[model samples]
Target: MSKPKAVVIYSGGMDSFTLLNRVINENYDVYALTFNYGQKHVKEVEVASTVCQTLGVAHKILDISPINQLMQSSSLVGNIEVPEGHYEDDNMKSTVVPNRNMILLSLAIGYAVDIEASKVYYGAHAGDHAIYPDCRPEFVNAMNDVAKIANYEPISIETPYLNSSKGEILKDGLTMNLSYEHTWTCYNGRAKACGKCGACVERLEAFSENQVTDPIEYE
Candidate 1:
């Protein structure tokens, strides 16, 4: 019997990298889908390509640049600077790309259905719910419903880390010997991660909580 197929909504960030490994570990014939939505985190697209190559998985980069035009308010799409602080800080809301997960998941589900994949996996965790509304549990559930209704085949959204903390997710990835250094999390889209951005701050804190130093470089 063949292994089940899973489509991973990969962003080449710590959380999604961990989720990608988890899906691979579970023996899924994985396909990685990444989006180039003209966000400031363009480096993540390159990182995603590298990570997928390292894992020997088929990867696709979808162009959703129209999102940049639709959601111009976000620091990710506009000249507004990405806020620097902890994930829990309210100012981090500036980084929210409006309905980002919704758009990504919709496209992912369509791809998954075309490929006859049974599941689509994403890495929405508790750590993101504060600022990213689309990462919240309710949004995931609603999107899952939409996927079910939209597809003729049985397809579902799988968010195993939906309620898990970033530390817990990282620990699982570490157990699988996944490399964290290849992942990019900074919103600044620079050569080196700005250590003060909300993404950097949260990732550092997760590593601290896990008692492991992050292998990624930060400026």
Candidate 2:
């Protein structure tokens, strides 16, 4: 008997990495999808690749770097500097890739329709509400409406951590005994995590809130 099918937007970051595992644990035959949209670094892609391989789940990295041209206003796409601060700070708006979630979810829904997967999973939590408008519940609700009507074959969009904080998401992942070492959250994508960056700081804080070692090195 085949388990149900689902697609996970696995970005190799702590949140998505956790989402990937959560879906698998739910007994879905998971297809892990990663996008190389020309971010500041490929380290997260590299990390996602390794973890997906280790888990023996089907995975693919799509190169949509050409679209980076349209998204250059954000610091994450081109030569702009990645600012360092609290994840909720207004300065971190530089890290926002305009229409990122919409674009990614559109593709993921298409993929799900192709694969006959009934649902698509992603990690968008409460913590992102302040910095990323698309991560908020209203966006998810709106996107969920579209996902069901986007095609003849309806698809469900699942956000398990929608109301949770980063720390809370990490807590669920920890309960699964997942390792954080396989994840990469640094926007800098340097040799070591620039612990000062917004992503890194949030990751570090999550681990702190859980009262556990982050298990990754930082600069």
Candidate 3:
């Protein structure tokens, strides 16, 4: 019998990349699904492709640029200036695209059903719940139910970060021998990570908390 196919919503960030290895290590056939949802950081998508390629997993980068126009109010889209400082600040909420995760996961679930994949994975950590409502455990559970009913199948949405912190995820990934240096976590659309951006600050903190220095270059 073939192994169960799992589609991961990978963004080449710490959490998603960790989730990718977690699923792969579990012996599931992994497929990485990346979305270009008009975020200021296009580097994440490029990094996602690299990560998937390195893992020898099937990968696809879906164009969801239209959603960017619809979500123009978000700081992540359009010409809005990327916010600097910590991820826990109220200013970071400005970057949240309304129902962005729902939209992405919905699309991934649809694709999973089309491909007969058994599980869909998303990286939603506890720290993100303060800024993103859709990243909450309740939201993920609700979406799982909705997707299962919408597809009329037993498909499931997995949130490995539901009970984990960003620091824990970095530690887990490091323990698994996962490569963190190539993963991009900047909110700015730049060649090198702007160390002041909210995402960059968060990533730095995670590595710091884990007592490990992040290998990625930052400016």
Candidate 4:
């Protein structure tokens, strides 16, 4: 029998990129699903496409403008300022989109059902909990229950990094042989990481904690 297939909700961010690598390491037939949710970083969509292509996996990009319209708290969606500094700091709250994980998981579940996949991988991690409540293990478990009930064939949601810090995620990615250089996690929507944005701060901290050098360019 062929290995069961899995779909990864990739966004070309560090965590999602690492999650994609983890799914691939499991040796399941992997497919990548990206969303164009009117984010400031449309470049992430392109990066996600390229990452999927490089991994030789099937990829899909969904138009989720309605979802984008529903989110305004996040600087990523509207004319809001991208906060600077560490994600764990108070300034990072500006980036928290309301119900982002709920929306993403709901859409991913629909796509997983359509694609006949039983497992969906997401990159919600401990590092996100300071700003994103939906990234927590409780929310993930709740969403998994929803997916199980919603899908005719039943499905499982995997968040391998749920309890792991960003540093741990980066280390796991290395073990999975991921090419981190191509992934982008900047909230500034620039060609290089702004280095001052919360996402950039987190990425840098993760690498530093791991005692590893991050290969991505930053300005």
Candidate 5:
């Protein structure tokens, strides 16, 4: 019997990389979809490519750089400096690319349909919900509903880490022996990760909680 197919929205971040491995481990014929939306962390696209090549998964990168022009309020794409702090800090809200997940999910779901995949998987975790409305559980539920209605064949959005924290995600990834070093989570897109950014801080804390040293370099 053939395994069911899934299209994963991969970002080359720790969470999404873990999701990719989990999907493959669960026996899904994995397809990775990455979006290049002109975010400050554009280096993640290169990282995504490396991961997909290493994992031998079919990967596609869609250029949606125009969205950056429209959502200039986000520090991810605008001239604003990327905030540095814990994920819970209010300043981190500036990193929220408006409706980012929704836009990505819409494209991913359509790609899933085109490829006849049964599901679209994204790595939105509880840690992000405080700052990103689109990462909330309610948003996932609603997006699943939209996918069901939008697809001719039965298709849905799957967010396994919707309620899981960054720490838990790291633990799971460690169990799978994922190559964390290749993943990029810095918002500044620097040569080395800006260890002070919200993304870097959360990732560091997660690895610490798991009692594992992160393989990535930091400055």
Candidate 6:
């Protein structure tokens, strides 16, 4: 029997990395999609490419850099400095790209429909709710509604980690024996991860919670 097809919204971050591996392990033929939206962390796009190539997973990367001019207030897409602190710190709100996940999910849905794939796997988790409004459960629910009616061929948004914490998501990935070295989490595009950045801090906390060493290098 043929496996079910899925479009995985892969950012090459830990969450999406884990989700991509999990969906592949679940017997889905995966098509990974990475976005190049002029974020400082475009290194993640390169990581996604390498991981997909090594895993023999079909992958597509989209360049949507023109919108960066509209979202200049965001540290992720603009020249602003990324705030360094714990994930829950209010200053970390600077990293929230305006409607990023909405834009990504919309494109992923279009890809899934184009390929006749029934599902689009997203890596949204509870940890992002404190910072990114688009990663909230309410946003997922609303997007699911639009995904259904946006086209005659409905595509389901599957968020297996919707209620899971970052630590829990890491645990699941570790259980699958997936390596985190293939992922990139730092908000900055430095050669080494800045451990003090909010993205690095949250990722380190997840690794600490799992009692596992993060395979990625940091400075």
Order of candidate numbers by lDDT, starting with the best: 2, 6, 5, 1, 3, 4
Better of 2 and 5 by TM-score: 2
Task: Compute the lDDT of residue 57 as modeled in candidate 4.
Answer: 85
Candidate 4 C-alpha lDDT tens digits along 36-117: 8888877888899988888798999998867777788789887898988888888788888788778888888888888889
RMSD (Cα, Å) for all candidates, in order, is 0.9, 0.7, 1.0, 1.3, 0.9, 0.8
> Candidate 6 residues 73-165, lDDT tens each?
999889899899987999989888888889889999999999999999999999888988888899999999999999999989999999999
Write the residue-wise lDDT of candidate 2 on 81-149 in tens digits: 999999878899999999999999999999999999999999999989999999999999999999999
Q: How close is candidate 3 to the true structure, as a TM-score?
A: 0.97
Q: What is the lDDT of residue 120 in candidate 3?
A: 97
Top of the candidates by lDDT: 2
- State candidate 6's TM-score: 0.98
Tens digits of per-residue lDDT for model 5 on 1-219? 988899999998999999999999999999999999999899999999999998899999999998799999999999999988998999999999988999999999889889889899999999998989999988999888888988677688999999999999988988897768899999989899989999999989998898889888888
Task: Give one digit per residue, the lDDT tens place, for model 3 in 1-219.
Answer: 999898999988878989999999999988899999878788899989987887799999998887787887788886778788787898888888878898898889888988899899999998787888999988998988887788677789999779788998888898998778878888887878899977888888898998888988877
lDDT of 1 by residue, 1-219 (tens): 998899999998999999998898899999999999998889999999998998799999998887698888899888888888998898888888888888888889889999989899999999988888998999999888888888688689999999999889998888898779899999988989999999898899889998988998888
For candidate 4, give the lDDT of residue 117: 90
> What are the lDDT scores of the predictions, listed in order?
0.91, 0.93, 0.87, 0.86, 0.92, 0.93
| Residue 187 Cα positional deviation in candidate 4, in Å, after optimal superposition | 0.5
lDDT of 6: 0.93
Model 6: per-residue Cα lDDT at residue 137: 91
Give the runs in model 2 whose Cα sits over 4 Å from its true position. none
RMSD in angstroms between candidate 2 and the native structure over all alpha carbons:
0.7
